[model samples]
Target: MEMTTEILMSTMNTTGNGTIDGGNDVVTLLSQVSNILILVFLMISMGCTIELEDLKETFRHSAGFFVGMLCQFVLMPLIAFCLSLTFKLEGAGALSVLILACCPGGTLSNLFTYWTEGDVCLSVCMTSVSTAVAIGMMPLNLFIYSRVWTDDKAVIPYVNIATTLVSILIPVAFGVFLRWWKKEWTKYVTRFGVVLAFILIIVVWVLFFMLNPTWLFAGWQLWICAVLLPFLGYGFGYSLAILFRQPHFKCRAISFETGSQNVSLASTLIVVSFADSPLFLDMLFYPGLYAVFLYIDSFIVIMLMKGVMHLKKRRNSANDEDHDENKNDKIGLDNEGMATDQEDGVKVVAMKQIVADNSVKTDEEIKV
Candidate 1:
């Protein structure tokens, strides 16, 4: 687990440098292929685990989901824009930030929401909806933003779009369908999917490291951005939830959803769209920093949530014990009172019988 985590961290950090080498191209390609396959398998597994009922539940919370989407689509991008202006980051840096903002929420949101005792169903639904929207929104947002900020024109590669559909959406739909048609298969796929995902993530990171050893120590600006952006995202999300009077759990979920951008997709887009340019090199920083911040911050948040949950459980257990003891004591006192009343009544009846017998015996003696 530790080794896998380290690899993921490395892959996330290797964003700007094209650290991948020609010698390791074959391995990287294989790893990317494997990653895609694993993702498909995981989606299938998710479909199996998700009942129609789960979807219904998710839909019921559509209002909350829409609110979250608004945060991602409207609020976050605006913030990114404002940040770009404040930082005076034009050209590649500005475009990169915009690209990060435009991309939808990713798979990690579900994990983080679950970790924080947030609504997993809502997170999943949001991911699906955001991904679907990204098909159109990603291109539009990038094109407009790039045009405004840089000389570079944004183009969404059709091949990459198709690949995304095949790898992500098709598999998810298939998984959902399989879950309804062949329930048992879904379970098997989900289990296998997890192992596959871990392996692919590891391979990608390893190849990244092998390709760019120096980048491992470089990209301080990227790292800083990564750390700060998520923190800002969470803060904004939580504040919005609080202002709206949303529940604590939902608040946590929204915070995570807002903060965790789709770094993987962003990285892929940068590679495919800007492979030749030095701008592509700069663009790498956004996803690299985003990934690094996400893993570290998420770990801390999850651990804190776990600790809080443990304390809550202990308190609840203690309260239950106290309630039970109080109920038992009340029952014992009631029984004792009933027993004393019965004993007094018995004594009174015995005394009455004795008086009657003595009076009858005295009458008989007088008659004799």
Candidate 2:
């Protein structure tokens, strides 16, 4: 960890800037195309999971929905900004946290929410809603937070990103249309999207690491920020849900939605916006780490929640058994007490009879 920063800088500096070239670079164009396609499919996939009725119900009881939105739009961006300041990050390192934090929740969160026994409807809606609003939210956040926090004056291309976000929403709208018109096809689309997403993640991971090996030695600041961003998001999100008095299942959904970000989107943004930057690989490092670490965190969290609930149920059953035993013991003692009272009554009767018999004998002697 101590040498990570030194290694990253020295390694990248020695190897020149990066292979991404500029905006017109062939690799950059290919990357942008790929990202757009994947994002469209994923967005469509996400939209299919949401029912029109669920969305309507979600809006009707919008407390959880609003709380989730607050966590994603408000808490997450602030967390990223604070981390940037705390770690004293600059340039790509600073953008690493900011970009990941700004991107919408990932599709994987729905699956995690399901596994965690959360409100699947709420989870799917929150993810979809966040993405739907990302066009406005992402740019607004980056605009507000990026300037003050990042010491390096790396160019943040706002217009291009806004355009990109608008373009991405088309497929999601189409997917919703499908859900409304041909409900049966939505399931098949969803399954295909899931498979495609996993394939994309694996392919990107392999290709990215292969292209830039030394990012494995990225600075501790990047790693720490990556870990902290999602963890804090989950904690604060769940806390807010509790504060708002949401149910347990709803809280888990909100927490996962809050914590899980779209790494694919963030990486795409980095590739599209910062391809010209000298620190492209460095910018890529944090999102990759976040993807791995947070998923591990999710599994650990899911198992812990399941285990904790199981233990609670067992303890409750044990207490109930003890309560039954105590009731039975009380009934047995009451029966014993009744038997003792009956014996005492018999003794009293016997004494009375003896007294009566003695009195009769005295009367007979007096008469004689």
Candidate 3:
């Protein structure tokens, strides 16, 4: 049976009280507040890692940055839209995928880049540039892609998107200012931001269980989104870089940057934007699941990168060994040739001496 858009959107109606039609008002309030705080912390911490030089460096090598942007804004969103259509997700499930695809590369990209021995500077630059660009691109991407599938543009929370963009930029700019003013304090402040981020992740975990314990078994489409989204990002990201002939390290950086969406930001947007919707309970559950799978998929990518590096190292070492063995064999042949020449010279010298002795002996016999 096909469900109508109105029925899907009406899953939750607003009650006279501050709650969703059937959800608890207190839970909704708590989730929004927590989401705001978490987004702030994650954005600020992400900012701390960016320096003015990193921004300039992105411009210095604008080609690579633009390539990364292509991957971030173009390839990923298209992949997600295709997946959404494939899964035939409706309502929140569909929106969740769209929102994630529109999000910029996460701070986790930098960490993964370092783990994979990628160009950290490029990774940082890409992350910062993408985040800043996302302020505008996020909305545009959603507007363009979501329309392809759904006609109800009202389903999109445009105001929340603006709010999320402003909220994210302010804290991030402030963090960057702090780093510029007191470089010494960036470490401590960044550490604190990380702690807050972790706490927020935990809050999300708890909310999943406390609010919607049955989400895991609700739908297979969500699982499809959770598993494929990040994998596609990683695959397409690396492929794009290689296709463009980007250096290997930069390729790795872009791969991680593409795959790791800012879960914290996505969570905040989902929680706050959908807070008033009756479908909040049903729709809000997918972001957390997406987060869980994104990380898992990224971890797998890291391990694969490590494994590739290990194999490359082994192959290089084998090549070096073969080169050395070839050199040794050449040296041995040269030494053998030198010994043969030296023996021939010695024999010639002895024969000349013998001829001179015989000539002297014949002269002495003539004198006698």
Candidate 4:
């Protein structure tokens, strides 16, 4: 479970205060290495579950997907930038927020969408596409934002995009290929992938909490921002869907896709880019807040959708029962009419026979 900022910060302060000195270069290096390994594993697991059919379906709804992506990649970053200016967040906090906004939707969005009766295919599509784009866009966005916000020139660390291609893209392609080749294996892989991703997320979050305790206590504002940002993303995405005259389900799906940031990728980027900066530790808070927010929001949305679906099913069941009762009544009336007709037919036959016998007896008497 992703710990709420309050709990994490408090726990960090109380427990992990002197365990590992933050000033130690070796510890920071270890943290970065741990984050990278976990990220690679998580990405690979996530990739294995992605089906080509799902991606194809996502593209089939290209207009909506594109629009939602634009909002996530473009509009969201702009909004975060504006918020940074308004709030005057400097150093790690400002960069963290900007990076968080720039990050694409998480792979977990598919699960949430499925839970909420949204389009899972679309969510998966958006996540994969956005993540691929993020390989380039993440560094570029950070550089651009840093230049505008800070007087000191910041260097965005060089990431091996090719390594991402190998680790993330290749694995995902292989997963999709496997789906095409052996569907049964794909099912098992998807199940395993889900479990693996969850475990990795838990481990990363725990390590982060262990490293930074202060972010847990006075981090109420970060928590608030995290919780609110996702809701805003969802609301804006939903509204856009409505504007596009999309169906209710598609609207909901797009909302989820827009709301859920790929925090795993964001965390990895932070570990890679800002491993040395004390100010950059705020990057840890960005994904930590997101992980917490996404968990809560996904649960709430899923429950609400389930409630609505349950009510709809109940109403439908009642209507079906009424329809069945009406059918039974009609069948009963028809059976009663059939029974009456059979009795009337029998009586008519007996009466005709009696009249014939009487006529024959009268003719015999006249002959006698």
Best by TM-score: 1
Segments of candidate 1 deviating more than 4 angstroms? 1-21, 82-91, 114-118, 139-153, 156-166, 173-192, 212-219, 238-253, 268-278, 354-368
lDDT of each: 0.67, 0.72, 0.72, 0.65
lDDT accuracy of residue 153 in candidate 2: 37
Give me the displacement of residue 271 in model 4, in angstroms: 8.1
> Which residue segments of model 2 deviate by more than 4 Å?
1-55, 149-212, 279-281, 319-368
- lDDT (tens digit, per residue) of candidate 2 on 1-368: 00011123233334345433242243333433455555667667766776778778877998998899889988998998889889999777888788889877776677667567687778877876787777778878888888874433334435544544555456656777899999999999978976776566555444444434555687888888877777788889989999999998899999999999877567667766676667676786786677667766777778887897789889999999999999999999999999999999999999999999999999999999
Model 4 stretches astray by more than 4 angstroms: 1-55, 78-95, 114-118, 133-166, 217-220, 242-249, 264-287, 341-368
lDDT per residue for candidate 1 within 1-368, as digits (tens), equals 11112233334344457464445556555655665665666556555566778789778766677678777877777777767766667466777777777777766666567557676567667777777777887877776656766666566545544554455556666777888898878767776876676576666666655544443453454455566667777778778877877777777778778877876566666666676777765665566546655778877877876798789999999999999999999999999999999999999999999999999999999999
TM-score of each: 0.78, 0.65, 0.72, 0.69
lDDT of 2 at 351: 100
- Model 3's alpha-carbon lDDT is 0.72
- Regarding TM-score, does 3 or 4 come out ahead? 3
lDDT of 3 by residue, 7-121 (tens): 2222233445734544544554555566667667766766677788876776787778888999999988898888878888877788777777788887667667766878766
Clashes of each: 1, 0, 1, 1
**Candidates by lDDT, descending order:** 3, 2, 1, 4
Better of 2 and 4 by lDDT: 2
